[model samples]
Target chain A: EAGVAQSPRYKIIEKRQSVAFWCNPISGHATLYWYQQILGQGPKLLIQFQNNGVVDDSQLPKDRFSAERLKGVDSTLKIQPAKLEDSAVYLCASSSNTQGANVLTFGAGSRLTVL
Target chain B: QKEVEQDPGPLSVPEGAIVSLNCTYSNSAFQYFMWYRQYSRKGPELLMYTYSSGNKEDGRFTAQVDKSSKYISLFIRDSQPSDSATYLCASTLYSGAGSYQLTFGKGTKLSVIP
Candidate 1:
């Protein structure tokens, strides 16, 4: 089966600019997640979607970031007016929502650089 | 204190050696534990998963979880060069509702030299 897919393997943008990343999760997977992995740290959850509805997004920066997972198949995470601190790898992962089973399959994240 | 604590080791070892990675958590509510391997420039992949306190073995990897001590470990037997990567320890949230949130450690970098 195909793994989770992310576009723009790498991205570079200036501060205050806007950037968007897309993710296509594995087929049959109902849970999608967006995470930010800063250098020297583990990925932190930005948003989570169970099918088309959001399950959690408490960590998301609502003022500068927004995400959507319409139709419950694909997802997009956008960061507007990117800041220097936003330079990090954005990862998308998916799981089968088997309840008690949350082993995530990750994509080859999109690396972002804010200059 | 952080929910999970891990030593960030750029640990280098020769091939065929045993590597032990560990993490400590303060939340006794964490019932599900996991270890993920992440390559440079890539996302993390689950290497092991275990519930509560016990040991689970798969191939050359062993995952041990001790809820009493709030400690978890991943042991790689006969490590290979390809196994060199960053290992992250994560604990699931208390809610059983589809097992939503996860708190991860800073990750330990391991290098296996051939």
Candidate 2:
């Protein structure tokens, strides 16, 4: 079985510039998630998707961040007019079911450097 | 206060020694506990998971949770260099919709000297 896959393993963007990261989860997994991990901090849940519908995004910075898991498959997380503090690693993960129970398989994160 | 707390230790130990890591959380609602290992430049991988309380063991690793104290622990016996990485403690409630979203602690970095 293949693991979760992500693109642009590392990205560097200027402050206020738009950036997007993509994620392809493990096959047959029904849950997808996006998280942000600032340096010296743990990953924070940014958004979660059950199939194609969003289940939670309470911590997402709605003012600048958005994500979608269209068709219940590959997902994308975007940040527009990004801020300097947005410099962090964006992680993507998946699980076998919506009731993940803390069992997750993660992809190599997209490290975004917002200068 | 942060809902979860953990020491971001750059913990160094010799191979074959037992290693212990821990986390304390404030949310009694968090009933599921997990430990993840992250290698450099790689994403976190689930190492162990426990239910509300008690202990679970897998091979050389053991995970313990104490709901009363809101404390959790992970112990690795006869550790190996491959175990050198960041160990993160995470927990969450049983809410239906957002069950996949986990609350994480800053992972503790462990180095096992050969």
Docking class of 1: medium
DockQ of 1: 0.65
Which regions in candidate 1 have their CA more than 4 angstroms from the true location? B94-99
Write down the TM-score of every candidate: 0.95, 0.94
DockQ values of all predictions: 0.65, 0.70
Find the 10 residues in a row with the least total lDDT in model 2 chain B: B92-101
Instruction: Give Cα-based local distance difference scores for all models.
Output: 0.90, 0.90
Candidate number of the best TM-score: 1
How many clashes (backbone atoms < 3 Å, residues ≥3 apart in a chain or on different chains) does model 2 have?
Answer: 0
Candidate 2 off by > 4 Å: A98-102
> What lDDT tens digits, residue by residue, belong to model 1 across residues B24-70?
99987776899999988778988879996889999999999888888
